[model samples]
Target chain A: MKGLLPRLIKRILGGIVMILVVASFTFFLIHLIPGNPVEAKLMQLETAGVTPLRAQIEVQAMYGFLPHQPLDIQYIHYIWQILHLNLGQSITYAGVSVTHLLLEAMPWTVITVTSGIIVSFVVGILTGVIIAVYRDRGISNALTLFSTFLHGIPQLILALLLAFLFTTIWPIFPFGSPYDAVLTPGFTLPFIGSLIWHAVLPVAAYAISSYGGWALTMKSSVISVLGDDFILASELRGLKPRIRIGYIARNAILPLFTTLTLSIGFMFGGSVFIEEIFDYRGLGYMLITAVGNLDYPLMAGSFLIITVAVIVANIIADFVYTAIDPRIRT
Target chain B: MSAKLTDRSQQDFGLSPEVACQVRDLNVTYRVDGRELSALREVSLDIRQGQITAVIGESGSGKSTLALALMNAVSSPGRIASGRVTYRGLGEVTGMRGEELRRIRGKAISMVFQASQNSMNPLTRIGAQLLDLARSHDLPNPRAVLREAGDLASRMSLDADRVLTSYQHQLSGGMRQRVGIIFGLVLKPEILLMDEPTTALDVLSQSSVLEIVRSIQRERQLTTVLITHDMGVVAELADRVVVLYAGRVVEEASTAELLRHPRHPYTRSLIQAIPRLTGDPGDAKALEGQPPSLASVPNQGCVFRERCPYRMDVCETILPSFRFDGDGEHRFACHYEEARHD
Candidate 1:
């Protein structure tokens, strides 16, 4: 107990240090891509009768950074902005701050990722335990086979297939935005309904693509727990089926939680694919545009969010795991 | 005294013919790969009231199957095919099912599993598990059950508070075994079946735990069935010993008499296998040949013929019927006796 605060401090310090390293790496690595956003924009402005030097100045002015500066100085500048919680302006989104753009787009991703995770985790663990309890049954074997098949399908393929099927063939659900453009955005029923309606496909893609893995992992975990001596002893102790199954699920669900949290960060990264495919205007979609336009601030900002998220989720998993499993509490 | 129990000799030996549980022709079978294998065939024995009856057998012997059968708990593909476990107060245990069976499991005939270290729910504290058991049996005062558990632990020379508060892993193996006993006895059940209680413990822990079991059994006058392969354990605790060979009870006698004059060839070999420091080193002959597995037991003859030193021609085909001793407390099944032996 005396070491708890120190341990927490060490963990949070490690996370911060990791985020800084990732930021510097992202900043420098993107710069190594040959031409800067200024160079890319300069060509377009050059054809508009602007001088080469003027075009460079205009593009630099847009993001408010000297693109020609040395790598170390720019790294220091990026770190300084990060320390101030200010990710500089987006070169592509012109006049918008990278922080603002991310904040605006984060919700859509959060909604889909969180919904996908909750649905999949609940369904996955539920199915995992059910199949494990009835492991010898034909239904369990068939369900297990189905889960394996679904889990093997790549996320990209799943997303693309979902997008094609729903938007092209069914056309019942809308695409290209988080909600209907006709309705004014508020706490209105129509707005929320459309929001949920739009999320179905992307969320489906995430839930379908990843739930199989959760179910399979959870299945093995549950099966092992079922075979444990305590389970038989529980029966000998005359523990009710409800109590027995609850204990089984409790122990079996422990390992999957770490995977669940770690997936949150990966879900953010996955947003680049799902959000783009569904045209959901989430952080991932903005990141794609930032990469295409070579928007240094926005790209660096997106990568930073992902790195920090993963690090934070990992830290949470470590703490949560220790809390849940008494054997590992110390 | 009643004519049935008029023999004070049996009473003086701390046992009686008053059977607490009469396992009559219990046949438990396990079906593996579509083939039914006999785990326990015609395993009959009397667990006398207030007597520790040790079922001694090799690993493959159906000691555990008989113990579980007392609770009427044979898992799927393995079941009590046809049997009547007439538990004195509870009537036929084999006839009970579902809720009726579940309710009496801990409250009437509790079981302390083999290597009880693994028998505890790892996630919960010892107290919580006790409360869970109490709740299941619908015991009104769960707090009293917890107190009784603490008291039981304290009496058994454990730190009661620490033991109750701690999880299963936190407790030592010996402590966990003791805790397992507490779970069984907390409901104050008349019958306590301990399956190899000391198997997973060190020699020191084993003795201490054995002493605890001995003291507890007397304190509550529990009708116990200690299932173990170790003859030393059988010598130490059992008032009566039932020697099981390949799922069949080959001999049943008072522990003293059985150890002194083991009539069955299998029982003789088992007793001989026990190493003693005082005896010549070569005098201890390790029993040759494996104990018959569930699938390998002969269908038409004596199960111990393969491992018996005195193998005869008649032993090959016809099964031997049980023959009684002068005391009638001693009974054995073997074709070749040579004489009355002792």
Candidate 2:
């Protein structure tokens, strides 16, 4: 296990490098967009009768630098600010810290997206194992076909279809917003129930859309595991059904853990349409809004947060991978 | 159908050592693309108790198939088409399944696979897997099983603690193979089936492993069935040798008798094919062509006549059944007379 220490440190270093590349790439790509969002903000403020000098100061202060400055200098300053954990201020929302805004939205996205992914992954893996074990049986074939079919449907369609079924046909769970807006944001059962109530469709959409791949990956993994000499050896040794199955599962499940942990990291940003369809005010909602308004700080902050989360998750996947497969210890 | 043949071979071969396991009229076939390819045809043989019986053949001769048939464990794609394999006390093993079959498998009869190096679950330690095997058979006191495994590993010249703790990949080819033997013997099984146990190892490792198997079988008096293509291994370890050709037993006798007087043309060629250290190099006749493929094996005729030099018109017209000769324990299937030799 001590072999993991150097490998862990190496993975973490690699992840940090990936984050840096993603951050810089996002920075330049945002600036490449035509028309300055800062000037637009300045014009809007001027129309609202703010003094011209005050507007200039407001643009500089919120943007951290004027757009006309040397691009390389602006890049260095931006990187420096990032190094100190400063994401500047939101251009769309005057005087709002971009980090604070993103932090507020993170929990909602995490609640829905993480729950959806976990539910899909767990259920899908179990289904895959079942299908693989009963591969010769009719039930196994039917489930495999059904799961692959479900897997083909896009997330947007899944969300819409679920929304239609729940909102019109069933009309049980609430459709829009994370919870009943009037319910104060607290830990009370009613508020929490309403929160869960709103997420059902979105979660269903994410889970249904992604679960098939997990099931297929798991099925193939389990099948390959079943074919290994060790599994047959276990059977030949006359290990009981329970013990044999345990060995199959232990080996089969190792490859899935990295994918599981990595997905956990990526889903923190949530998916755009599902969040938008529900108007859940999660990170994806903020992301779509930022792009629509050309809000540089919000967009940049969102991208950086997602990049960091994924990189951290990737490092975790390496740790999890090494923990299970002894062959990969070094 | 083949019981009469076994009895004839028994009478021909004088020794009356106890029969440890009996395989009668065993025909195993593999289906590929809807074609039934025969792997073993009416293969019958008796494994003597407290002795090593070597089943010898080339690849595709179904020597391994016979080993699997003894346990009624022929893998899928290949099935025991029709056969009766009976252990001494277990009655008909072919009739056993599920818990009873499983209980008899590792407890009464254990097998060492062809690639014993790759036969272990790589994730678990050897010690843990040994315990798992113990628990599966409901062997009481799991710790005792671990202790026994450690002892067996030590007996095989493996460092007990290091071997038990190391994963399969951590062990060398020779060490992992010894661990495989440990798993087989840890149950203290009555019958041990080793399927080409040394095929996957290097030459040095092969000799070492064969030595271990020899020492172990002698120490425990374990009734062992050794499936191999190498006659050298048979010479080194086996007490009795059975020659198989195209999925049928072509010859059977004590190791010394068979080597001295091989009656079957295929057996004689096989014996002559071995390169000798002292004799002239040109005298060693190589086995021409190959053993018959499953589908290519003729349904009616001598199986080895195509590659056999002493071929006659009768061999193609009628399959030669087992024929007795001097010292009743020695028997062979051939249309040729016993006077034939290199």
Predicted model with the maximum DockQ? 2
Residues A153-216, candidate 2: write the lDDT tens digits.
8778888888778888989878777888799999899999988888888888888888998999
Give a tens-digit lDDT track for model 1, residues A74-178: 667668778987887787778787888888887887788889988989999888887888888999999899999999998989999998998999897788888
Off by over 4 Å in 2: A3-10, A43-53, A68-73, A261-270, B1-17, B279-282, B338-342
**Residue pairs with backbone overlap in model 1:** none
Please give, as one word, the docking class of candidate 2: medium
Interface RMSD of each: 0.9, 0.9
Could you tell me the TM-score of candidate 2?
0.92
lDDT of 2 by residue, B65-151 (tens): 887788888877889999888776556778877776887787889999898888898899888888889989887798999899988
Q: What is the DockQ of candidate 1?
A: 0.62
Backbone clash pairs for candidate 2 read: B12-B328, B12-B329, B13-B328, B13-B329, B14-B329
Could you tell me the interface RMSD of model 2?
Answer: 0.9
